[model samples]
Target chain A: MSELLSAEIQNCIEGPVVKYGYLSEQIDVVATPQSGLTSSTTGNRVMTDTISEAQNPKSFLLAIEALERGL
Target chain B: MILGLFVGESFAELSVAESTPSSRGTLREHQRWYLPKHGLKAYLQNWLTKTPHKPERVIVSSRFLYKLAGHRLGGSVAQIVTSGFENWSHFASLPANTRSTSLRQLNRCPSLSSQDLIFAVHERILSDGSIGKPLDLSEIGAIHEKLQVLGLKKVCLHFHNSNLNSIHQQQTRDFLVTLGYEIFEPPVVDAFPSLEPFTRWKTNTLSAAVSGTFEESMKEIFEGLSAQIKEEQIFFFDGDLRLHQGEPLYRLSSLFALEACLYSQLSKIMNTKMKSEKPLTFLHFGIEHFSYLTDEKTLTESPWGTLALGTQGCRDFSIQPSSLLDLHDDGSLVTKGNLSYEPGPIHLGRGHKPLVADLLIQETKWPEIIDLDEKQARTSLDRWVLLMQTWQRSVKKLRFLANLLSVCFEIK
Candidate 1:
């Protein structure tokens, strides 16, 4: 992860998170490039899935692990 | 060359004078649908988390999800609520035990409200329910106060309905302006969507029978209702453009038509209203699809919904096409006159056929004198060119990335 995306993910994790009424102490960051070739094909899709997975922490970690294998 | 933005789907087409190669270059380079489908969650999350900069005044036509947007946008959100006083079990899920009262029925509808930066649309009453009733000024005043408390920076009222002449519609406009709201009347066109991607099947023959400035009509309406609604608070927006919503396939076509009207109207509106500030692109929730995106899965699926095509912005079209203004595919500005539509070759496959209205802009610009006030015309043309260039560049960038990814995978 580049410094900027890593930072953004970190911020999403550390900052106050209130989405659909879920509260989290620590949120993991999954960084994806928006511009590169990898991104044009699948990056946005992966990121969307990750955010959704993070909706429930248990599934989020499992999804992240599964996603990493594809990468 | 005079640059006219023609917004409509397959039926309506724009024509531009073939003055310079740069003209074609400008149109080709600039054609884009600004709203991107991907990365909405990321984009919205980024927008909300950012520190509040300039507060936005938001107005919504529906009462569906003001709270969600309010929480996210963090400023104020206002609504111009409109409705027929009746049971709204379809829209508002009321408790079964609570015997529905007519007053409670009235409350179920959305009305016009404007916060500083955010403006809300008034719920549309298509039939006999809500038009012609004298609106309560207190209701208007109370809504304005709520908008103020919500940290609104500006207020604008947008109302759309089929009954253009009803007493209640007039009163709604009168009420909003009395509370210091900028009221605009958008141009209304009646057209239906196409079933096939590229082909447009004009089932009903449509025309712009009347073409007078809606702003002028609004002034008359406001003045007529002035006996009930106070006069001092109302401000009129000129050359407002709104399109009729019906049919499904005409989604892209109607979108362009609305865009064209908005483009022309905004140019006039900004010049007259703001004087100094230019109008930034305003992203509105698609009128028909307002209720669709709450479920994340739907966002990724098809971008279907009435909000995308069925907007009750202006109530002008009827089934038999009577008692309304008609318009033509030609670039002429007709008001309060009848327009007629004749069937054309449906050869253009759905999505692939170059949009009729978009093409018309190029064709229309081709013959007309692009010359206006030397500086103003140049500035307008330049802005159009810049917008086109930005879109072309964005699409090109996306396509390039897609191709590169394809190559990399093939190499592997």
Candidate 2:
């Protein structure tokens, strides 16, 4: 099967991608996934809920501290 | 007679068409300049009175179309939340695409409420449908006075645990309404009551911020055409392009960049340049180039944050408004993400700056809008590019088919 995909997107897909000219088969192409990046929406560093709380405080007073301290 | 009243940023047009069993017959359209001071309703009322046949139903797409088109709410909106959750909207529920994303570059996406306007009043509802803290009715007068002084009429209330216990929100809403204020209904709070608080808060607040403007615009269009058609007969479209009857929009944020929704729909039916046997991704190239989403994602599933929220899902998209600069030395194009709309008549020879259209279409041919000098447009662009080139170190020039899409990257 043929796929008209961007090289940027193709760099991210993990599985083997085959490029064929209409009916021609056996043209095997492997998609090498981009290094140092997860395919999932969530990143490698999943901050805990408490950390998120520090990141976005409920109180404006807490936010002042969150900003200076680099929450 | 079936009619469509389209209210745009600059002008409003009323289109009358005869709908047939098989085809849409010829359309007799009348264009009217949108003059807010004179009142849209009166203009519409005058126009409708002149029509030979009574208008059965009019689909009036209001001035909110401008806000939706450019993701800019007309007026400032104030948001009231549970005392603790003052910065609730700052925590959008959008997912992170990559680890490498720099926080500096990661913009705090389309915020509806002004930071100064977000008021945290004394009110709290526990998750168990219990009122932890009752509504502080005392806070109402001061808030109302502040609103009045600022000329800010619209207010959105989002209390913590509002889903389980809406007493505080209702009380606040009532209190705010008594003060001659336009209280906006929280987004999706009625329908999706169990949404995660962060997502819920962001969604509700964004809608709250834009809803007042949306309502006002709708009111202008509807009131103008109210003499001709019933309120129920008036129709509007969500971002998914699904026709909905009357207001209290399903997902207001989805309506941002409404034309992108149309483009999303068009991408589905429009034949692609590259025909492939397997699943294929589509890329659209025009004056301003854009890559369309995957096929499955194109279908109208959930259009909540389609345009407004600058969510970097799997991809982060940017917009460059009018005026493309040239990397003259390399014969490449360069532009920054202005994301501006109909960037004020520059190409029409009104604005001081020179737009891309001015460079290409000027003198060569007279466009839809006239009164332009091509030579001057090129000179202005050349001067602007020279000014920008001195500071901007990195520039990306993309060649697609024959056209060059020059995009300048922000390096911090």
Evaluated with TM-score, which candidate comes out highest? Answer: 2
Candidate number with greatest DockQ: 2
**Chain A TM-score for each of the predictions:** 0.21, 0.18
What C-alpha lDDT does candidate 2 achieve relative to the native structure?
A: 0.44
- lDDT for each residue of candidate 2 in B1-412, tens digit (9 for 90 to 100): 4565555443344556544434443344434343432356787788778878565765444434333434534247777777878776555423222322311113323445467777778877787888777777888777777888888887777677777778888888888887777776544434333555766555555566556566776677677777767777766545444556545544363343233332332332233422433333322212222222333332121112322232112222232224343444454444322322244324433344444433443323323222235674565556555544552464454232122221111111
**DockQ of structure 2:** 0.02
User: Candidate 2, clashing residue pairs?
Assistant: A58-B84, B41-B224, B333-B406
TM-scores for all predictions: 0.24, 0.55
Model-by-model DockQ, in order: 0.01, 0.02
Residue B115 CA displacement from its true place in model 2, Å: 4.6
The whole-model lDDT of each prediction reads 0.25, 0.44
Residue-level lDDT of model 1, residues B1-412, one tens digit each, is 1111121111111121212335421221111111122122232233334423211211001111211111122123233434331222122222121211211112222322212333333345444446444456566666677766765423323243423434544665677666665443322333432222111101110001011122233344335334333334222111121222222223223322332232233333335644744433211111111010110111000111112122323211111011111122342212221111111111111111112222222323311221224454355445545544554554443221122122211111
Candidate 2: residue B410 Cα off by (Å): 24
Worst 10 residues of 2 chain B by lDDT: B403-412
